[model samples]
Target: MKVLIITYYWPPSGGSGVQRWLKFVKYLQDFGVEPVVYTVENPKYPILDASLEKEIPKNITILKEPIWEPNNILSFFKKENTQQSAGFLNPNPTFFGKILQYIRANYFIPDARKFWIQPSVKYLKKYLSEHKIDAVITSGPPHSLHLIGLELKKALNIKWISDFRDPWTEIDYFEQLPLTKKSIRLHQQLEQEVVEKSDAVLVVGQTMKENFSKFSKNIHVITNGFDNDIDSTSITLDKKFTITHVGLMNADRNPISLWKAISDICNENADFTADYEIQFVGKIASEVRHSLEEYQIKKVLDVGYVSHQEVTKYQQKAQVLLLAVNNVKSAKGVITGKIFEYLQAKRPILAIGPTNGDLAEILKETNAGTIVNFNDVENLKKEILQLYSSFKNGNLESKSNNIEHYHRRNLTEKLAHIIKETVS
Candidate 1:
């Protein structure tokens, strides 16, 4: 069997967006599926890691076409105001920035990547005619990629699967978009169309699957996972009681309660103050920085944008791994990809968000970590103290169980089964 994957993020372009499909492609051949990747030739990627190129399987076909994104033109007007990546919602906007946000929310329709839909559909229509692809899959954030698959399904009548790495209309930042009522309805309409028309809809978490179940019966929950190949044994643990978060810490993801709790703990406990160090390992929003400063937390190490290989090392070294879900209306559904990687690191995890949410469920099931509510400063402080006490006693470790199910290769096997069923 052969599958054609339509994705915006690919190797040489790094971060959580690229990892899911990249790992799927890496392991699919073992399950008797030949993967053909279709991606942008030149993308305005917010983060880049040439190291990820090493993960691409040898002798696989990678198709690329040039994408004309409006962000390229709009970015020139407000270079300082423009976000380096998508999904980082600015809680406060300048007057000019608000104008750009208004245009992006209302005029851009689905996204700035909407411009690539027509051109991609036109290019792929001819290519599909000659190709022996048995099934089509489109992954999105730039949900515009799904429009291409939707069009191809109509034109070529191929078996198409629409994969939601993140929710579209229900995304955390949707409310912050400055969207008009009509624009909001349009987004919902497009989201419904993509879900209902596709042969299958794959989502990263159970909450997403439940949310989209009204639109499509063929929804599947395929969570992002960790590669088993990474060598975790060689990494040396940090001497300090390092609490590290390893991905983009946007304004929404900034755990204010946790910071406040830690600040209070540092002031009250002399031993913790002497040993504890907070480390942020990727692109941090300005708001996150301001919050840290407000707490008067001094021992901060901002090691921005390390390669995937380096990230694994950081994860292994940390005394406690931190996972912060976006404190938004959609917080219950927001399961960031780093959670599984944290599980694989075998370090105790300290997470802050909806305590009754999907992430908390996983942490509870695996016995990998402790979770506190977004505003639960008392419990947050208690959890931190407990982890710190365990660190002092040399008992700081994650007892993650039944975690083989979350290995990258195992997850790919499950994905291949879906592709086979869809094609058949």
Candidate 2:
């Protein structure tokens, strides 16, 4: 079987989104499918996660098409949103940030990826004519890729699968965008259209699958999993109780109160104060900077972004890995890709997020770590002190063995099954 995957986030440009497709393509061969990837030449992605580039397979074919997004022009204007402008140079958004958001939300079709649709359709239409593909799968945040798949399904009568890394209309951060009322309705309508048209719709977590079931029966949950090769090494945990968080982080996901609590207790307790570090190693939100500033925690080490291989080393060295899920209505369905990596690390996790979602459930089942409700200062503080005491008293032990089910090859095999069933 020949499968063509359209994604906006692809390696060289890294993040959680890139890993899904990259890993899928890498493992699809085992299930008797040949994978070909279609991605944008110029992506309006937030940052370049160079670490993730190593994960891309060398043998797989990749087709890159030039994307002329209005964002290039909007970014030139240096825009700012009136409500909450970080007033910093946002990598993607410029001074015309508000204008760009307005144009993108209102003018761009289903999602901002609306810009990629025409070009993608134009390119893929021509590409498919020469290459016979068994199936086409489009994963999104750039739901525009799905729109192109929807159009292709109509034009060529080919089986198209649409994967949703996150919910479309159900995304918690939807309201944060500069979308007009009309555009919001249009976004929902377009999302439904994608749902109605696609042969199958893949969601990342169980809650996402349940949420999308109200709209389309096509939904299936094929979750994110950790790379076995990356986690195969043995790591010796350090004596100091080091809590680590990797990947892109923002204030909303950062537990400020927890940091404050840690500072307060450590100040009072010499044992707790002796050795504890909040190690953050990736793109950090300004809100996190503000919290770290407020608490004056010099131990909040910003280790910038490191390569993917280094992530394994970092996770291995830390006593407790940290998973920060945002607090949004849609957050209930969100299971971060980091959790799977954390599981593979064979270290206890200290999660700062909701206690109800799939993440909390998995953590509880896996005996991976302690989950504190988001912004629950007292509980977070208590957990920190407990961790400090455990480390100081030599009571900490690896508890990640229970989550072996989240291994990458198994997850990719699950995805392969979904694709086979969809095309059949």
Pick the lDDT winner: 1
* Predicted structure with the largest TM-score when compared to the true one: 1
lDDT of 1 by residue, 67-173 (tens): 99888888888767466555685667789878988898899979999999999999999889988889899999889999999999999999999999999999988
Stretches of candidate 2 exceeding 4 Å from the true structure:
49-55, 79-97, 230-234
Q: Assess candidate 1 and give its lDDT.
A: 0.91
List the candidate 1 regions with Cα displacement exceeding 4 Å: 80-82
Alpha carbon deviation, residue 40, candidate 2 (Å) = 1.8
Looking at model 1, report the run of 10 residues with the lowest lDDT sum: 81-90
Error of 2 at 249 (Å): 1.6
